[model samples]
Target: MQTSLNHYSQNNEIHKDIPGRKEIIGYGLGDFGYVLIWTLVASFLTYFYTDVAGIAAGAVGTLMLFVRLWDGVSDIGMGILVDRTNSKHGKARPYLIWMPIPLAITTVFLFTVPDVGMTGKITYAAITYSLFILLYTAVSIPFKTLLGMMTQEQHTRSMIGIVGAFFIQSSALLVNMITEPMASGIGGQLGWVMTGTLFGVLAVVTLYITFRTTKERVGFVPTAKQEEKVKLSSGVKALFKNKYWMIITLFCISYYTLLGFVGAELYFAKYILGNASYFSIISLVKAVPGILAIFFMAPIVKKIGKRNMVLIGILSIILSTFIKYLDPTSLNYFLIGSAFNGFGKGIFGAMLYALINDTVEYGEWKSKVRTGGLVNSAASFGMKVGTGLGTAIVGWLLAFGGYVGNLSQQSDTALQMILYLNIHIPFLIAIIMFLLMWLYKLDKIYPQIVEELQRRKNE
Candidate 1:
């Protein structure tokens, strides 16, 4: 690994060279759009479904759990599909054009309050969500894998990621800030329907921009088979073999699972703060630091390299939880700590993909196949896993607290329990994630892997 930096530094050409600057910003913003829509749903959707839309709590949890499991399994196959695609635009970009319409439609559907029986609601959520995330994987895997093919260096890729994270968080921030005001201003079912439709459109447009701006850099190697190559056995084997990849995926799984609970701040603000309007402020406050995080990302990754940045991010979040848990009953401290958690999350958020670029290089050297989309497929599943589990757990907990979603109607006992779980449980999970990361070992070998691969290519 020692000589690898010099290898790339000294030589100018390589597979999946860094993406152009315009492409970087475009992808970041585009991904942010998709993430924004989904994060809103993830953050507030359960509350929306249970409290607002009237889906039962356990049913909502169960539906999310099932759909995410399906999404996880499908991710492996989608990765294979990306590897096999032979488009003029490249492996991943066609999905960019084809996916947005479906992506947009499905996202809107997830938010729709259909007229149905209790069983019907659960079925609607499970089926629509399953379809939505499946399409999401088809789009996102390519999007994420492009990061690897976009650049070879840790710093440059991290720069792209930094920009991407900003867009994602910003999109969510925008939604968080606006959803209530927009809904309340308009009033009733029409208000919610209007808000969702607007965001849904924005989501598609942003993703379209992301697709238009970026070019697939590492595609065009001839292959014996694209579809056949991406089998479940092969994809799973490939992921597990890369010890570093497994570690990265695990950390990501845990990181986002804990972080997904961040979505519940709406519940906290509305139910606990006793003012649904404050949800808007929560969005504004948390997002300000995320924007600032973009400026600091490159330098942070540059100084510590990528893996340590992940470690640092983990530790930072863990410590922030101390403030949250210690406060226990204090809303001020919990909200304040959440902002810092957002900051820590923003830093490592995009940097992790920089590490992924290195793994893509390593995988190419070992397996002699480029599965950028497949790599992202795994990541998409991990995201879904975190998100799915976050919703499942939160909904279940909300049920425990007797949160009926209608703040106007919920019992005082239920309100207090809702507040307790919203603040404390996620905090405990954040602390566990910190300890979990201490076990990773991928950061020590970037230059080593590069040197070995280069020597073989030369020989």
Candidate 2:
């Protein structure tokens, strides 16, 4: 290990290779696979559990809250595992190669509701969802950590994020456009089973490409002694001490909490808007603005800085969502609000991974220990908590409002609750995110941090 460190120090020049367009596109392709699975589960899973699989709303919500809580715990464990790993394939990229097939399998199982009774079905949901979250954490933590490992240039990382957003939103749009129609056309449980299988296959292929094409630099290979000293407690301590990381983690939790509104859209469209297929239209509307936002994201972040860009984006969401709340039933108002919300989401989404990557650097600079996996894992932990809580809110709110999945049309109380979950709740969360952004000042100090790290490395 000492020899390895000396070699790395002596050959610091070897780390300067910039990723070409092919590599960048390859990296972006990984997210295409990732979001295909993620968007499907995040956006559609709750609806599938209740409306399709015949689970009660409250049960589904409670199940998700517990599963996601376990998922959060596993995320931290996966992070530490990645940090401790020293393999020929590199620290993070190996998981991309190994886990895709299992991820695909679990995805299929998640959608394949059995012919068992309610107890059986709930058990199936728990078992399958747990496995899926485990596999997802295994792959996702590594994939996210890859950003920091791939390059040290902030601009390059930002560009990778931009390209990635294009693929992520594009995959999400495709899923939105196709998932419902395919499921409905196929007639029952088999429809969802088929949809999951198709996306799962695609996920495997794209992830393999990512594993093959991307290379990891800035790799931290710990000595046995160093590894022995790297306790989970220490990693957790390092994470909390970094103010920037704490701020970003909070931002992620809030941002994703607002994003929980996506889970409610299928119900909103089916019950409130009176057309399940309208989800495709709303998704299209949202995707276009997000794609457009990607085009301007890098430049805007470079100009006003990440914090300011995020502020602008969150404010856009709050404003548009508020407008939608005033008149929730109007088609034009819904579309218009969705467009602005998508635009804002696109900008913030593009900046977010890059900002998190910055936090890894900030953490290392502050703590003198480079644990990219733990830092990114901490961020992912927050996101999982947000996702679980957000989904729970939607579930519990629907149950409280007398949502009955088997009914042709919901009661007025249920529709009103759907409206709140769809528009107003997220609007409030966006305001909280805006407040969180004010505490993040890393963008102002990042350059100095980089230069100092470089100086220390050379010395």
Candidate 3:
């Protein structure tokens, strides 16, 4: 180990190559592609199920829960496939290239509801949604793993993640601003079909740019002894043993849960606030501040570290909770509160993928096997499950509160339920996320972990 440390410290080429500006921006475009579709699904799928397709909220909720959970579980298999893959384009990058068009096709299929009976519609929803999730996993896990493979250095990886988050938030902003109005303007299923198609074309283009621009600089080449120990069961066990990974996974679940229910903002805007068009305005308020906040991420993270910056972001969320509490009905108050929410999301979003990639080095150092795919897969699992539950909660609670769709006025119970979802639940989620992030101690030891991993690689 000492000899390996000396050898690695003496050589810069082994781990010190920084990606160029074009490369970084190109890599970032991948998330733009991803979030274009992802935001659409997360923000409006529930509304489509209920108002557009005429499915019962509870049934849609159940389907979302089951399908998303299954999708989360499938990430494990995809991770293993990524680890074992030996492609010319590279393990993770190949998926970015191959999966985009199919993924785009599936995205369209996911939105296209067939003219059929209720059961058939449900089945169509299930099959199409499931296929879409599977394809998303195939692309998403690799895109995530590509961050770690892009560079072993934390700073470069963070830069990549920051750029990526910009795209994610920006794409989300674009989707949020247009989807509702576009669909309404187009008037009927045709609106959604056109929106999905446009986004799909854009997704394919950006992803191909990602494939063309990004290069995998870091890869694991295990010796015979190391290879023997890095089996599937052992890799899975090693992942569980990573304390930082566990904390981040839990945090991701909580974060994505919050995101899952964010779609309910449309309902909040339409029914509770009495204007459906305000959904765009709300999204505008939330997204613009969030986009601007990303510019501060590098400096703030430098000053306080990623974990602390995230903690501060959570505090911002808590503040938004308070702001909304003052007057949930006032569009003025809601917009003000949403600005804070966007700011927090921006900070956290900038840090999240970078933080997840950091865990890979820690995992490799402790386990003696580099399992980037597996580590990221577990994180994906948490995200999917959290999103599932979050989306389901909206449905279940709305159902429980006796929600009726397409009505000019909601029952008192339903209105109150929407209020709690928008106001109270975020507060609880913020607390949980804050606590989880507080428990995260990885940043303190990350440098040492990377140094140690570098030594092992040299050995």
- For all predicted structures, in order, the TM-scores are 0.90, 0.95, 0.95
Candidate 2 residues lying further than 4 Å off, grouped into runs, are 1-15, 221-229
Q: Write the per-residue lDDT of candidate 2 for residues 1-459, one digit (tens) a residue.
A: 112112222234434676767888899999999889999999999999998899889999899889989999999999999988888998899999889999999999998888799999999999999999999999999999998888877667777888888898899999998999999999788999999999999999999999999988775554443456467787788888899989999998988877766979888788878888999899999999999888757666667887888888888898888778878888778889999988888877678888998998888789776788999998999999999989988999999999998699898899989999988788789888998999899888887887788787766
lDDT of 2: 0.86
Full-model lDDT for every candidate: 0.70, 0.86, 0.86
Q: Model 2 clash pairs?
A: none
Q: Write the per-residue lDDT of candidate 3 for residues 40-89, one digit (tens) a residue.
A: 99999889988888788888899999999999989988988898887788
Q: Compared with the true structure, what per-residue lDDT tens digits does model 1 show for residues 103-141?
A: 777877877768798778777878888888888777777
Best by TM-score: 3
After superposition on all CA atoms, what RMSD does each candidate show versus the true structure? Answer: 3.8, 4.9, 4.2
Counted clashes in each candidate structure: 11, 0, 0
Arrange candidates by lDDT, descending.
Answer: 3, 2, 1
lDDT of 2 at 450: 79
